[model samples]
Target chain A: MTDLSQQLAFVLEIDKLKAVYRQTTVKEDKDRHENSAEHSWHIALTAQILKDYAEYPIDIERVVQMLLIHDIIEIDAGDLFAFAEQQDHAQQALKEAQAAERLFGLLPPQQHEQYKALWFEFEAAESNDARFAKAMDRILPLVQNMNNNGGSWAKHKISQPQVLARNKHLEYIAPKLWQYVVQQTDLAVSNGWLKKD
Target chain B: MTDLSQQLAFVLEIDKLKAVYRQTTVKEDKDRHENSAEHSWHIALTAQILKDYAEYPIDIERVVQMLLIHDIIEIDAGDLFAFAEQQDHAQQALKEAQAAERLFGLLPPQQHEQYKALWFEFEAAESNDARFAKAMDRILPLVQNMNNNGGSWAKHKISQPQVLARNKHLEYIAPKLWQYVVQQTDLAVSNGWLKKD
Candidate 1:
């Protein structure tokens, strides 16, 4: 087989990995249930949109790379409900790191290092790209939850303070995006989508 | 809640989407059965590693962006098996585009536009960045399949000619990566992982 064809075959095989999640809406509208692929795509786009708002003169490309792979570890760790017991966070992170190693290793060696680095950067959230990527990563779901009438939070019995406490970093990372999220949260509370707590 | 915290929450929500197809393995090897998020990460890294090898002077940022969001549509369209019936390709693309519209739209308006543009460019495959991104997209899986001993090709009953016809564009897109893919395919066939056909 020719080289290109081999690549195509590889691409075709990657598609099978899409069935890991079902993206259900706990208490939100039908539109709120996005698949894993959709979520990553949206966040990567979020990175592009918010690149300019970064506190530093960020590398948009690096931010995009971070966003694209940031959550891939979730595949193996399973989506650790953010509001779940905080103790699980460490274990989840460990599982995700292992997943990252296996998944990113799919590329040729040179490419593998590049991705593994970006994934690490995002996880570390120390670099400007990682910070910005982390910020966008936090912002997308607030919009989804608000738009969907607090779907997951309501279903999970998540409270306003819990939501606020979990997501306060947005203000420092991207103020504008954060401001928007706060407004949505208030609206959700007033609308009774979430408890005042 | 602080905006930052809210934004972080958003990112966590997006992570849930990958649960749809995270651990799936097609006819490919365990490593090749990477999730969509991992796939995006790998391609972006591939773009970075192979950036120097491009025949033309390309915008690395644009290429990275393209790689990051290229397969997101697969979330909605579901992945099409490469060797599956021919009629599904167009249908899958259409579904993926629609999915892109909704998913990318989740970002703030400005971000929505920026991300949509990157996704569109990758889909168009007309620009230099797009070409390089496309090449990386093809190359990653080629490596994985070859390393795994023709993991998917043999199971799917793929022919050498069919593989070549589908992937020849890699030659023009990124010659070095294409060369590597060709070498790997030869090795796989020689190892009896793939039939001579």
Candidate 2:
């Protein structure tokens, strides 16, 4: 096959993956469920909006790439709830890391390096870009649930303190965004969107 | 509950949604099946990496913002497979608009407007930033599949021509990125990672 055709086939394969994402559902929206593609698109935009408030100058492009590939491992390991019991956390990371290696390996050598690096950086949350990206990753969902009146949390019976402890990292990464999250959380509690601890 | 607690609860609700996203799957690699939070990060990074090649001058900040919020509606609309046979393409858009209204509404009224506008710009895909962002959105999946050796395509039996056609839009928006995609596709086809037409 010619190069153009090969690329076309590659894209077609990715489209099939979209089906996997579509089949998965979130309880947050009664009529809606998030898909993998849409998830990637939303977070990239979140990074853009929150870039200025980052603790330091970051290469916005790197942050976006990090967000885009950060979760691909879920394809193999399945997604672990951030607040799920800790017994499986270590095993989940190992499974996910192996999955990341295999998946990223599909790209040509150079491109694979590029993507893998970004994924690692985002996971580490060490760089300014990664930190900012991590902050947005933490922030977008808060906005979604608040607007939905704690659609998923209420459904799942998650406690307020549990939620706060899980995402407290946001406070250090993007304080302004963290502030916004704090304010929204307060509103949710008073409105009965969340159970008081 | 106090406003502060409510706000935290609200933000935590979004976090739950993110957890829901983390659990979702896409047929692609775990890296590519990335949750919404990570997806946003990748696109912002893509913008930065390819910013120099944008057809027009782009406000990187605005472009980044557009990338992040572009998919929040997927929180409601779910992801629509670009290549799927849809009876009504506009149906997803309508659902997304509704989702946006509720999701962005969580912010202070003034902040809500700020984010909504960014989302609108991304949806329009008219400005340089939007176009660049849109280009990144298209290209990332292609890259993911290419890296994965067309894993999802072969599984789904998506046609090569269809893949090319769906993604051709990127050519008009970001020529260099488009060219790179073509190169990768060529490699995929030659390696038998994808079937020839």
List the TM values for chain B, per candidate: 0.82, 0.81
Error of 1 at B68 (Å): 3.8
Candidate 2 lDDT, tens digit per residue, B101-146? 8887776566568888888888887777787888777777667666
lDDT at A39 for candidate 1? 60
Report the lDDT tens digits of candidate 1 across residue range A87-172. Answer: 78878888888987876666556556777888888888777677778777666666667757677777787777887776666667
**How many Å off is the CA of B156 in candidate 2?**
19
Instruction: Summarize candidate 2's per-residue lDDT along A1-112 as a digit string, tens digits.
Output: 5433433343334333333343224544443556555566556655654566666678886777677666667767766665677878889988977877877666545555
Q: Model 1: runs farther than 4 Å from truth?
A: A1-39, A72-79, A90-127, B1-42, B49-56, B69-126, B141-157, B187-197
Which tens-of-lDDT digit does each residue in B41-69 have in candidate 1?
55674565557778888998878777766
Question: lDDT per model, in order?
Answer: 0.64, 0.64
Return the top candidate by TM-score: 1
Cα lDDT for residue A79, model 1?
A: 73
